[model samples]
Target: MALQIFNVLGREKQLFQPIEPGFVRMYVCGLTVYDYAHIGHAKNYIAFDVVVKYLRHSGYNVLYVQNITDVGHLRDDGTDPIIKKALRAQSAPMQIVEMYARSFFEDMDALGVIRPDISPRASAHIPEQIKMIQTLIRKGHAYEVNGSVYFDVTTDPDYGKLSNRRIDAQQAGSREEIRGEKRNPEDFALWKNAEPEHILRWDSPWGEGFPGWHIECSAMAKKYLGDTFDIHGGGIDNMFPHNESEIAQSECANDADYARFWMHVGSLTVDGMKMGKSLGNFVTIKDALKRYRPEVIRMFVQSAHYSSPIDYSDDAVQGVARGHERMMNAVRLTRRALATAPQTDDGNAILAAVEKARADFTAAMDDDFNTPLATAALQELTREVNALLNSGTTVGASVLKAIAETYDQLGGAVLGIIPATDDSAAGNASREAGLIELLIKLRSEARAAKNWKESDRLRDELAALGVILEDRADGTVWKVN
Candidate 1:
């Protein structure tokens, strides 16, 4: 089956035909690097990582580019006082860019996300951004106000096409207050006039200032992937002003569509509330990694479809941990079964099951990269593999190899949840034992105080951490896996 993905533009799944046959060029908008990444950031990046992985596995040469936004993102809330804190902290703009850029890579690496082929920073492509802005000005799509350049929303008839918003229909002056020079409230900045205190300023034809957030993406994406690319991806939150403005600026300047497919992943929520720094309910990826294995975190993000909101909670993560372990157990059993199963030529049933699972998985993924369905298909295969083990069936060497290969291709190469066999398993066992003992002591005190939520939370967290606490009629006993 040909691979298909839901084009957000058309709001339906379409067969994926790359601009260049047999090759795919993809871009994902990356972090702004003002702070440590949260789980929401993880969901966006990991979802796209799986897409890139599956595309490559399906025999497409993929050139993936994810940008590092080390500059130009402003403090949306007016009260923060210090705008562009990241740029001002370092001795030079490049220092700030490299510092946060490296940290972003480190966090992504810990989450098992494969690094992109090219990670261009906004600061490095100033020339390209300036050139694009100049083109927009020459094309009469933009105008200069003092040192700042603003994209005239009135100039482009298709200004809000990406977000499906009409410029005239929008609430006037609802967003950031328009400067006196702006022609309309909907017009967005292409270049900002840096204040004397602005530390990240650059000398340009528009005078000393930095590129706007949307302009950086248009400039860098076109610089690397040309005027049009196969796929452009980001969080759904970017759909309105950020992505919509990108389409307007790029299309107005280049006289062509900006991208073929616009993919937007949904946000990650905490207890049904959106997770953001301003909300003060956000958990950093580093804090999450300290508790759960990186593979477990990746599985948690992939459990839901990319286009659907994923509610994050202790219970939700624990459920994912259980599911991930079940998958790993199947992998281990398959490996052991392969090692000892008798070699024969008559194991075609198992071979057929494996092939069927692969075909089903590919088909589900072809339908708009339905990861949730693809994940269910993997679970079904795991059940079948376990059932074959329990049935005491004799398997041929070729069939065993095929099963192992399929598991590795889907679980390891694409979904990226392969279990690691290492000395850390022993360490995990010791840690669980220690944690269980500590929790039991705490539970005793909680029970005496009638703190039900505390006791239950402690018990649930321990169980989710892979420590099973069995409460018998007589008493509670714990076991560490």
Candidate 2:
């Protein structure tokens, strides 16, 4: 099956046909960099990360760009300029940008989100943004007012095509308390004039100010991916004002479609409420990582479909931990079985199973990147491998090796789980020695007291830890192998 992706712009699952054959250009809106990253951020990025991984696995060259919104992100809840709010709060814009950008990257790295090919910051691309805004003004799609530029949404008949809202309807929806300078209520700013106290002011044709929130994306995306690109993605909340304005300004400026496929991941909720800092139920990624394993957190995020809301909670994370442990145990057993099998030249059955699993995984992914289903397929394969290993049939080493390779490719390379095993056993040896010494000391104490129960318990515990103890003719001996 051809790869199908749910294009939010068209509101349909369309077969992905890259503009350049065999190459894909994708962009995702990054964090605003005003606070530490949260599980919502993790869910969005990891979902896209898997999409990128699977696309490459299926033989597509993807140039993925995710922009970091370090500036031009407003602070106030309503339509007032965010920079004005920042100035009133007496916080330097760059200071806020630097502090939060660092926190965002740290949290993302902890969550194992592969850094985008190009992470353009809005502040760094101000010139590009200004240029685009100028082109929009020249094209009569934008106008300057009081040293600020605002996109004239009234000029673009298809302004709300992506969000499927009529311009009149949007104007009616936004009728109350409209800004007097805007030609229409639906019009959005391309540039905001800086007050004397605005710390992020820059020299622009309009005035000394920063680019607007939506303009940075249009500018940077066009700069890197051309006037048109394969994909543009962000949270669903950006659909109306942010992305819609982007479409109007960009298409009007360049006289071309901005992006072919628009993808928006759903929100993350906590206890049935949307997870936001203002909502007071937000949990930062750093705080969650301190409690849960990073892999468990990732698994929790991936448990749901990208276009659906993922509810965050302690119970949910614990459930993910349980599932992760099961997969890890399966991998461990597969490795041991492979190590003990006899050598052989050929193993067709194992090879066939591996091929089938790969094919099934790809098929599921191609169908709109159905990760939840793809993950289920992987779990089923792991179950089959474990069952085969425990059947007590004599399997050849070649077959076992094939099973190991499949597990590594799917689990490590694709899913980003299961760290690569190193050839040196120094770490394992040290751990084994420490465990053995502790177990022997406990067993001797149990024997001294003639406590059979305690002695058996100690032996069982060691066995659970992958250690085996045997009573020899001379004395008790332990062998790691």
Best model number under lDDT = 1
> Which candidate should be chosen as best, given TM-score against the real structure?
2
Model 2 / residue 12 / CA error / Å: 1.1
Candidate 1, superposed: residue stretches over 4 Å from native? 77-94, 169-179, 345-348, 420-481
Q: List the residue pairs that clash in candidate 2.
A: 74-82
Per-candidate clashes come to 1, 1
RMSD of each: 7.9, 4.7
**Alpha carbon lDDT at 358, candidate 1:** 90
Question: How well does candidate 2 score on lDDT at residue 427?
Answer: 36
CA-RMSD of model 1 = 7.9
Q: All candidates' lDDT scores?
A: 0.81, 0.78
- What is the C-alpha lDDT profile of model 1 across 1-481, one tens digit per residue? 7877888887877888999999999999988866678889999999999999989988999999999887787766521112455445735556555666677789899988999999988889999999999999999999999999999888888877778888764555455545456878888889998888776778999799988899999999998898999999999999989999999999999998889998999999998898767888888888889988888898888888899989989899999899877777667656655666667744668777787789888888887778778878888888887777556567666677787788788878898887444222223356645666678889868867999888788889877986665553334545445
TM-score of decoy 1: 0.84
Tell me model 2's lDDT, rounded to 2 decimals: 0.78
